[model samples]
Target: MPAPTRALLLIGPLLLFLALVYVLPFLGILRWSVTLPEPGLEQYRAALTDPLVRSVLWRTLRICAIVTVLSVVLAYIVALIWVRGSPVQRLVVELCILIPFWISVLTRAFGWLALLSNRGIVNGWLQATGLTSDPLTMVRNEFGVVVGMVHFLIPFAVFPLASAMRSVDERVLMAARGMGASRARVFWQVFLPMTRAGVIGAALVVFVFALGFFVTPAILGGGRSVMVAELIYLRIFQSPNWGLGAAISVLLMLAVGAMLAALLRQARPGGGS
Candidate 1:
């Protein structure tokens, strides 16, 4: 068979699987968003105007933004270290970063719960040390949610950055150093600009992942810090408002799609240059 035909044949099964499992179900959701319980825009209007939904959407965006920013900063630092470190140091740091990615999301969230809860490890230690009489509220709040999300997102941020940093020429830094440039100057002027693509890519990845986060926020928020995903769950499963749930889901999908489109446009040659 021709090379192009052979490549398509190899990918055909995966495409079929995606169509069956993803495309069809998503199409169903779009249909239900408008057609269920009578065809109209009532569900969309309600989702847009509902106070609870507005609050949840805002909270989700806020938390995602915080997580994305924190993750990118921390990951950049780690990736910088990884790129500049010795082979042994690189291996150890990479293991530490990748180890968490192997664990299940629910497992990691529960681990945070145990460590951050009122009577959890940190609070217990604080009380035992006579630092405070009462356990401080940590888990089941925005703080806990951000902590979990940042932890989860850091690895994602690191990989892209590490790849980008590896592409940076060390000779450029050597030239700057030989010219009597300060270390900070070399990093700020030469290194950071070279990593812009990685930073943007990592930020986009973390933000998108954070927006769809449900398990971490649900477990950490304790009903008080509901996010968009949890709100969708409640609308669909708890209240049986399928139409509204579908509408919210569609909105979320559209928002994510728009972001991806913008990112793609910027990525094109001379598009954002």
Candidate 2:
């Protein structure tokens, strides 16, 4: 067996599995999006032009943007701390971060519902403390949705950033400091630039994940704050508009593919300085 043939043999099962599970199903979606009712572009045009679909798509983008920014900022701080912390501190922080990842997303969302709802723990505390006369409407809104998404996505943002931070040479920082550079200047000039790739990678990962989120937005946003995923659900299950749903899915796939391509270009060697 030649080296290339042996390598192909090793990867053949995984490739076959991906084709069977991913490629075939995706092709089915593409076919259905166009041909469900009749072979035409009606579904695609409707999805693009429908006011409701446009609103939902915009809302989804807004929520994902908020989640990505919040997750990246918070995760960067945490990752920086984790990188600088002692071994025990690192272990404790890692455990805290990974604990949420181990739990089910549904469980976490529901738990947030209990904590953020009108009569939930937070409101209960506010009222008990005479902080406000009325229970604040927190859950089932944009604020709640952002909170849930940020919590869910922070771990994802953290791991990539931590990997990037770990790759950064401490000696560079020492050299900068020994040259009489201010701490902030050293961080801004030396540290952040070195970690740019990781930051971009983490943001891309979080934004993409946030786009497809269903359970968190559904539970936290209530009915008022519908995202694209929830809209897709309603189109398929509630309204029985499978064609429209598939069309929306197709558009989303295209948008995500374009983003992936752009990011890949930036990630290639000699792509960025």
Candidate 3:
């Protein structure tokens, strides 16, 4: 076989799988988005103008942004520590990070609810210690949703960054320090720049995952607070509006695509932290 044909033959199965599983379903949702509810961008219009839908969409994006920021920052610190720390320290911190990922998402959400609820341990301790006159609302709100999502996303952000940080050249760092560069300057100029692509990639992965998150927001956010994913669920399962649900799914995919595109654009050239 010709070289190009051989390469295509090798890659064709995986490409076919992606088309069957991901691309086709995505395109189907895009079709549904247009066809649902009398067609012609009605769902898109509802997504923008309807007060409830708009509020949920805005809240979801805001939470995803906050989670992405916090996750990236925390992951950067943790990744640096992992790269530099003693073996035992690295083991402990890595395990601490992985433990959350291993735990079921539902269990994690339930644990957050237990800790943050009115009569839960956190509030109980606060009341006993005179931190407040009464239990503060924590779970079943925006705060709870954010807390859970951030917890879930930190690992997603950290793995990429840690892998990148591990690949950094220690000799370069030492050389910078030897040349009289301050610790802060060395980190900002050398270390951060080297890890920039991984950071952007990690942020993109976390943000996109957070965009379609359902369980964390649903369980922690209560019925009052709705995310796009939960709204999609309501449309499909609750109201039996499959078309509308598919339309929202398309919007979700588009939102995620926009984030990926932005991150990719920033990733080009010499972009860094």
Model 1 per-residue lDDT at 113: 97
**Model 1 agreement with the true structure over 1-273: per-residue lDDT tens digits:** 899999999999999999999899999999999997889999999999999899999999999999999999999999988989989988988898989979999999999999989879999999999999999999889999999999999999998899879989899989999999999999999999877888887888888888889999999889889999999999989998999999999999988888778668656665445
> Model 2 lDDT vs. the true structure?
0.91
Report the C-alpha lDDT of model 2 over 1-273, residue by residue, as the tens digit: 899999999999999999999899989988989997888999999998999999999999998988999999999998988898889888988897989978999999999999999989999999999998999998889999999999999999998899889989999999999999999999999999999988988898899898889999899999889999899899989997888999999898888887778668767875556
Alpha-carbon lDDT, every model: 0.91, 0.91, 0.87
- In model 1, what are the clashing residue pairs, if there are any? none
**Candidate scoring better on lDDT of 1 and 3:** 1
TM-score of each: 0.95, 0.96, 0.88
Candidate achieving higher TM-score, 2 or 3: 2
What are the root-mean-square deviations of the candidates from the true structure over C-alphas?
Answer: 1.5, 1.3, 2.6
Model 1: CA > 4 A from native:
265-272
Q: Pull out the clashing pairs in model 2.
A: none
RMSD of 1: 1.5
* Residue-wise C-alpha lDDT for candidate 3, range 1-273, written one tens digit per residue: 899999999999999999999998888888888887676888777777778777888988898899899989988888878878999989988898978867999999999999999999999999999999999999888899989998888888888898888889899999999999999999999999888888888989998999999999999999766889999999889997777688778878887889888877766765553
Compute the lDDT for candidate 3.
0.87
What is the TM-score (0 to 1) of candidate 2? 0.96
